[model samples]
Target chain A: MKHQRKPCSLEHARFLRARKKNLAIVWALRIGLLVLLLGIWELVTAVGWSDPFLTSSPSRIAKTIAGLYSDGSLFYHIGVTLAETLIGFAIAVAAGCLIALALWWSETLRKVLEPYIVVLNALPKIALGPLIIIWFGTGSKAIVFMTVLVGIIVAILHMLNAFIATDKNKILLLRSMGASKLQILLKLVIPSSLASFISMLKIAVGMAWIGSIMGEYIVSRAGLGYLIVYGGQVFKLDLVMSATCILCVLAAGMYFLVVLLEKVLVKNPDS
Target chain B: MKKEMLRFSSVTYIYHTVRGETEATRGLSFTVEEGEFVAVIGPSGCGKSTLLSLAAGLLKPSEGEVTRSGSCGYMLQRDELFPWRTIEKNLYLPLEVSKQNSPELRRRAKDLAVKYGLGEFLQSYPPQLSGGMRQRAALIRTLATDPDLLLLDEPFSALDYQTRLNVTADVAEIIRSEGKTALLITHDISEAISLADRVLVLSGRPARVSYTHELDFGDLKNPLKRRESAGFSGWFEILWKELNQ
Candidate 1:
């Protein structure tokens, strides 16, 4: 409060207005770039510079989406992928934090499991496609399993780093107060590691989407990912392009949700 | 007759690091009597912090015994208030840690916040408060646990000169008003003189008590007032010479 110079209300108002104006300009520019790219793409194919069949234009993708909507498959595919991703994101974050806590609590367990966790993280997850299908069968379960597998290791690593990086001084203060390990973890470690946890969730969102789509690419009867594979097989390039576009929007939407969660959870989020 | 609250008898501490061993303190002995405010002054890196750490049970002495009559509350150089918690919640940390989070204790903590002029800021985060207020809140947090003694480790050194003067006075007043014995480890000669009933000067590395002075500024209450008292600079200069030696 002493450092606060206490700007005049009029000056503060002007500052806020200028910031809002800059934010509006930024959003406009982002949308404008997306529109400009779409326009160029459409123009290239509309003028016959590129083959429309080979390189589907934005209008074609839009038309393909409309066709899927009318047939009621658009929502169905979106719902399938969205459900898998959200479920996987939740499970991975929870399990990851819990496993990290366990690893933190037991130094020996962390030592034994750390190298294996690193190996699993390094392994190409898509290579597990056949084993996953055989174990969970060609269903949403296999896709969900794939999603969890892709994200859990990264979650554990990031969260473990956060838990271990809690301030030594604060830990000492708590210990001096006769705090038990469980109390220390609950009061000090978990609350302070919130930023790391939120960032981990943000990363896991992308991994969940990738895992679900990879699973669908290997074996799936539905989901936008399945549509992409089916469209490729049938040479419906517009369908593939449309499904890919939807995936982009879905991933962005999930990322936006995590950002909002960060805003809600951390009062002073490192923006 | 004053009762003895804490005693560190022939305590020696040796820090073990990758570079080998460095002796911090050796044959260090002192006693804090009930209701007494004692300050220890030494040169920088002369194991002032190590001594407090040993007393707080964060580090054990390599030799000899450290004895205490009751629970002790430790205040660090930095006001380590949890950034995520509001002021009121941060004050509850020790109570929560000790499994003493009763409704009465929470109310008393809130009352202490209000009594200490932090009523309006009880719901604010630590970052939102001034440095002085944060330190006050930290002291209140240490007080909330109702420990038999308080160990303050250069608690006001991080503040600006003006804030440091004001905060030390305020903290000294609070500790005195609460009737708690305190062991303050500081490098400031005047600050050590103003707040403490007795000042102990320790020599550099392999720290042990080199000199002791019993302050007798009768009827001087606050730290600010103590500086205004007669013979304040006399005690300051004497301790200054002792510390520099």
Candidate 2:
């Protein structure tokens, strides 16, 4: 048995080596593509093939970011946006889960409110921008509300579907064991929907960022969105580009954070 | 003189949908006595599941009386083990839900797993185990809370033929050794004849007990042994004819 197992282990090792090599090649290609794109953009602007003033190159964006760093405003703008996004995301997930539970608890309530939820999810959220500013008066409060608004509806829908789609047999088993409704919810429904919850978080991260940026675009004194608006108005395209780059990095970082959370919480990949 | 564990007397169940109300079972009457392994066989889509649900007390009868003496454990067609939980944790689920959580019950549940050849895979999740092992885990889970009656709804139908035979033997051994009353609903004639002390056959839709038979195997409790017995084919033929008619 030991002699037979040796060849099988050797085959498994070879398979693992091939997989690692393939992953390395994919990563190298991804990085190479990004570098090539940036290099070409720089070359085009420097050779005067494209106007640098209109479309800021990588170097100009970097220089603008460096200047923002020296003035200590880069971190400030990032912090404001990040705070709004995190708080809004946390609130949206918590409140959405609670509301979904409430809906699951009472079928009558869900029936009455489901149509309105569908309508709200359908109606473009940006259409409420002007009213939002009037109500909250152009502050961080308004931005946070916007972020929550964008994310909460999707969260509710995703979680509610997951809760309802729980296996009927498992519920029947629980009922046979004399489990109450609350017991069923706690022991079965909530735990079973965890995969959906993680997926919802992944989606809500993107929505949260969009909401904060959209809110900032409508009204903000300091944020990446504000920087872009101010730079565009004053014709400083490099500052706008720099702010956009920072937003991309921030969004990616937030998305990875959620991915990390999914890894920690969801032990069963099949589930 | 045997104690009645479950009694369903002229039980009727109606399911209401947007289209209309459909009667799943009508005037279904049966009684399972203590330490009896009774198998109820029916045609496919003959409200077998509705019968199990009614026995488990998950659905109340629309017309007749349904009485269960004590708490019952239900095992479904699919193993229905929570994929997210390890086999051990899945076994503890019933105990947790029924508020029977204690060291003694947990230990007994673990002992059952070890006794049933699942000791090595107790820490493994449902997906990691084979189909037969998962079903065994599911049975152990059902027995965890020590319910008085076991309501089995075609628990072996999901398995392939080979695994189904082995699992049938294992389940019969466990239920018999544990001395629990079990009411298993299945469409498999051989399974009904092999594992059950008494067999009840149901008619097509709007199910009712059309026939009942007490096997003369006397002390023959092992499922595989019963299958190899001379009387097994005769019993199977009778049941098949009854079901077809």
Candidate 3:
């Protein structure tokens, strides 16, 4: 039987209007809350309720950003940090996929290397900072290496779980049709694990940021991390706060990019 | 020669795990002749699924020989339609995996989708379709490989009781129309009676063939029509007794 939906156009329009109104309120509240917090901070500092030196005022941060913008160093720092993060995130995803595939392809190799991977994952990656600097030298290479080091393990773990957890029934279905190992992997294993791959990318993006920042804390000539370190050392509280705020915006931007990519790549039911 | 499509000569299957071995089926012997529709009914957890696994050559018989002619297609209980793929793409999977995804074959698969009442849902993913539609897509997927023998393992169990009846009838009609030999494993005695040209009642695990019934309701092809036949309840009653015993 053909489905017959009641065409209550008036009710439908009213429902849509209510939904839109509620959504607009939610967004308005979100922005309003942020503005209120910033306004309070500015008020407190301007009215001498708190020491501006200890707690940097929003106006001071804005003035510091304006200063950096005129100096041409702001874009340079943002560029360096973004490039490092993107490169590190890319390398880690590619290498981690290859490693996960290797582990999946050979049970013996997986068994032999599984323990070492676990140990590496458990060990604090920041401890390896000094050694990484020495091996790659005190440059962007060291920071990139650190970023990759932080991100690759989690990527491998997420993907390996997904690969191993491929539906055994689907594999059997393929095998019954005379499909070979490569056929099954290409047709079933990888395609079915796309969600896991995207999840790993999301997680690894955060790791990449942490690694780059941590590396700069150890040693760096330029980048957002360096700006923060330099600002801290010079007792420029406004610069420190400004750099941190920029980092937050950039990280959130990259995360949204990944979310957009998920929209494009994953055919998720809800998405 | 009746052109044997599949023959299981005293097959025995033993499951090995960390907790040791469990014999799922033992001395299980049967033959599916060409163009036959056979249903196997047994107690729950009676290694009915194991029988299909062995027929599909996914499991080795520990003690007996299994000879199957041509390719085998397996239809699962949950439909196992890839959630990411559209109905058309889902049907194309077997062909793609088999490396026979020619334009001609793709067209044929699309045609099958249209013919099977999935025409409107060609671009819709499995999740968008109802449970019964998903199962139909899965059956079409299995049939895409043009397998000589189809092994159906409780393919209708996941549906609601009402949908189950309709889908069982639909699927049985499709299999018959395709002229492929089918070995269906179901616990539903009425389902077995309605769909099968022959019914094999199985013993409890280490399951073996307990008894066999040859059914003849001349021109009683459709599952609903077969169920409505005067002889249908007679077969259900006999199989029920055999299964209980």
Candidate 4:
């Protein structure tokens, strides 16, 4: 009788066990780096190596967060800032998609508007903050307008390139199948540009936050940006640091939301 | 005996560039019979794609008439399935474009997907599919509109050698089973011999038909099986010599 070979289940199990160990090691290394940085910052402040008042340690920022939470000011300011960022982002997306569609539809209009778009995109959006406040009177309207101004141009540029770069052969294929021009745009062009559009939306999320913050910095009654400016005026470094941290968390949350939407819509996790 | 589905009479195409006009196809005349599979083979840059383009009404002939009886579905070399759309949505693209998006048609498209092996992957995006599956999905998308004539422009040239053979067999069976007329433009001699009922070989640029051969491989249906037939090598050798000449 000839000897038979087995399936080598032990080797397979060993590979799996090693993979788990490697993943755990990577996670531990990441957590260790974060802890070490926090520990060093705390140690430096406690030992009088750096002034906690000026550079506000992580513990001071954490205490400030708790204090603000107890007083309910943190939630209120966060709500206001979030509203501004979201409204601005929504307007930018709508306007940007529309402008991109218009440019994709007509070469003549694209040619006519190309120079103006380039010039406006090159201009510093921050410089327009004062003019926007003057025009919209330092209210939520000014913040929203500034956000749209900052985010829409970049979104339009990205989406337009996506739309224009759509597969020409595919377009011709659709056209030969008796598809109308509007149908091509809705079916082929829109579907093809969706991934790029999602990426642009994620980018616009950050720009929207930045725009909203700049607006709040110039003129706002209540917001995280206003809190930062107010804290700086009163020489409260902890408050300023806490407000910055909150902004970071909020922006990250929004960005992750867009990424999740992309995952659901595009259905390709790798992309 | 079949009725003529497409007639290309003295069709001439010229590539008008900044340099000047260079003829791509000169006075090419051919007629595709109804329910026939005709493969156009030629050397590289010999206007095979131009022929399909003219047939599909994508490119207007500079001289003479290129007329077809009914609607045309053109498939490119690469499977251009939209990465964002599900396989099911991609299949419904033609119907959606034609404003034929009835619930019944949508269900039929789904049924077709299921009838094909893609039922399990209907909700999957293009990137999730293997190259062969994507091509099948693309073929389904092309066939969704129920076009009278299908123009395949080197639709399998992108696949690897092994995958190409399997895909060619699958596609040939699918097209034959659907009872649709097809015009395949390819440079692969074996591919042309295996899938087509008739093959027309073209010469270099300003392309014209050099020879037309009627392929008969007895009862061999699958392309790979057909390749093992006695007549397969003979046809391939003839085509290879003609292509080189």
Candidate 5:
């Protein structure tokens, strides 16, 4: 006699519904916190308890953003910054994965080249802004170079660690079954290192933004960073705060994009 | 003598560190017969894993000759299935490695999965399956290459007790049905008594064979039923006493 398994319970359905409700509650709380902070800032300025000139009231920042939007400067600056960040981040990811692969393939090369990488990573990449500007001459190229410099070493280190940390027994098992080295690398090592690589990309997104902004601050005619510098030079605290807010929003947006990519890659990693 | 599926003649292995050397297996010797299910039971740290490693050619014997008639398949303590791969793709791993990626071979691999109760979960990843199903999938992957011998290095040690019994029965059925020889290294005496035709007991580190018991549990073919046989506890006690000695 063949035994048939019982159907799943409605209790499981109820549990899943409750979990979705809890998730909605948490997201609502997060938005509420942001609103509360903004309201407090507006109230403080209206009561004359805080100087709107130095701190730049939320309403003034919003109006400044609206004015820039009406005149099209806001979109232009955003476009410039976004182009620099994406190009630099793409180059960094490619170069970083290639370097990690090279290091993993050769122990002697890794040992010989490791100290140089350490030295390069230790040097403050912000200091390279002047050199990059001199070489690439104050355009997207310099900003991209700076972003790659800031982000590549961290990506290489993380990916190499992930490759080396794969299960040794599985590798041995494959080898014992007469698998070639390339087969082991492709079938076992790379797939296992994917979660780590996605995490490194998230970190690189933030570092790339930092590098781009720092480059702009040192030597650009236009960008969010340039707007901040221009506002400071002309003593318009409102413009400076508005640019800072834009940068924050852009960075948060990129971080969330990477988080979405990670969700797709690992497909429910740790929930 | 079934052409001596594997022969290890006077093999000795030593673990060397900066401080010194510690011997794990001192001039141990054994042979596995073709299509035979052999279980190796020993005390803790008695180099059971070392023996499997040597047989798999992962480690060369320090002092003796180790020869195998055909290719080997090794299953580890953990399932070691890649989380990113679907069950069907995982089953094709060995075929992929051996450059046997033919459509017929892939179809046969799928048939094996279907026959082993993984038909519905062919597209599922390792994380989506239960522990026993994962183990079954792993075994199917191991058998996909049709290797001459299987080296099981405590494959059930990671499973809970109930899952262990169920998986053990499934594995025994699979090996017998597929007509493959297997060498299982286990610390559990009853496990050895129930699943294996012959149980080889070894001493503590620097291990050597202390006793070899041939078991017969009547007409019973199922592992659980074999465990219920009258002679089950008797063989277990004998193995326990031999391990203690």
Candidate 6:
């Protein structure tokens, strides 16, 4: 049996090896491109080809980040922004799902509010910054509210479409068994939308960051967004670059965490 | 005489949409007795699905009554298994929904799966199973509650010809052995003739029973045998003409 398997098994092994090699090559190229872009920026700045004052070399950004680290204020700003963003994301997701469920529960309510929802979604959120400041004041409360405001609409729209798009046959099957509307929602609707839910989370993560930073841009005292604003006002280009870099890393980290959640929560990710 | 399991008395259903109200079924009357397998055949879009929905009580009749003796288990065209759930969990869904979930019922459900050759696949997700296997799991899930009536909505229509025949045989044997009353809606004349004890042909849209035939394949209770019997094609020809006319 072992001898008979040798020929085809070797071919299978070769195919697997080629797949692994292709994946490695793809990842290597991704990293290599990032490193190459940074190297060129640094080389051009160091050689006086571009004004380092305006562009801010990678080395200068690194130095500014180290300074923030030594001063022990690095984590504080990160914590403030991260906490606000996470809290806003959670509230928006929860409240949005509830609102979507209510809308799905009543055709009358959905029809009545459909135009208003579309209008709210279309309106530029930043235009309401002054009103938000007036309502919540210039505190973390305002920033968190802004984050929720940005994320919740997206969550509601995404989840509502998913809820409405649930398989009609599955709903019929459940209904035939005497399952209540609530039961259908719990057993079929919610469970079937895990993929959409994860995708919504991915979008909400971006919206949460946008809302927080946008709020900070309006009236923030301390955050990466605050640092970016203050650094710009003071003409400290290195600080601005460092804060932007930190925001990128934090956003990527949060996105990866959502992806990780998709892996754990959705048993059949492909489906 | 077997007790009456389901009765549809002058049932009429109209679907209201933004465009207009369309009458789907009109003055449709039928009765399904306990322990009998009844099949409904009609042209496409002839309100066959509307009839099942009415029977399942998912929709109320527009102008008449749909009365059933007990609860129903519904199987659809596609398997409609929740891909996120294991076969075992999917089978238990009806029990959970009906508030009849218990250790004994779950065990019984599991035993049914094992009996029907899904023992090894119980831990597997629906996506992991073959199409035929998924449909079988769906039938088992329907039977989990031991419903008084089983409403099958073109349950074999999704499978390819080969798998459809095998699964049809399996489903017929299972239903017969369980002695469950079944109402199957299909457009396939051969399928209607092979499986049902009594076959009801429906008119085109605004459907009502146009003709009803009692199959006579004496002692050929198995679907595959019923198909091989001499009377199978004769009944099929009759249903075909009735359906076309």
Task: For candidate 2, give the lDDT of residue B68.
Answer: 89
Interface CA RMSD of each prediction in angstroms: 2.2, 1.6, 1.5, 1.8, 2.0, 1.8
TM-score for all models, in order of appearance: 0.92, 0.96, 0.95, 0.86, 0.90, 0.95
Q: Candidate 4 lDDT, tens digit per residue, B132-153? A: 9999998989888778999999
Worst ten-residue run, lDDT, model 5 chain B? Answer: B213-222
Model 4: per-residue Cα lDDT over A1-271, one tens digit each? 2233655588877886798899999999999999999899999999999999998999999999999999998899999999999999999999999999999999999999999999999999888776887799978889988889999999999999999998998888788677888888987889878889888988999899989999899889899999999999999999999999998889899999998898678655234
Residue B30 Cα positional deviation in candidate 6, in Å, after optimal superposition: 2.3
What value of lDDT does candidate 2 attain over all alpha carbons?
Answer: 0.91
Better of 5 and 6 by DockQ: 6
CA lDDT, every prediction?
A: 0.92, 0.91, 0.90, 0.89, 0.88, 0.92
A233, model 4: CA deviation in Å?
Answer: 3.6
Evaluation by TM-score, superior candidate among 3 and 5: 3
C-alpha RMSD by candidate, in order: 3.3, 2.6, 2.9, 5.0, 4.0, 2.9
DockQ of each: 0.56, 0.72, 0.68, 0.53, 0.55, 0.68
User: What are the runs in model 1 whose C-alpha is more than 4 Å off?
Assistant: A1-17, A268-271, B228-230
Candidate 5 deviation (Cα RMSD) = 4.0
Candidate 1 per-residue C-alpha lDDT over A111-199 given as tens digits, one digit per residue, 9 for 90 to 100:
99988998998999999999998999999999999999999999999999999999998998999999989989989999989899899
DockQ of model 5, rounded to 2 decimals = 0.55
In model 1, what are the clashing residue pairs, if there are any? none
**Prediction 3 TM-score vs. true:** 0.95
The Cα error of candidate 5 at residue A96, in Å, is: 1.3
Better of 1 and 3 by TM-score: 3
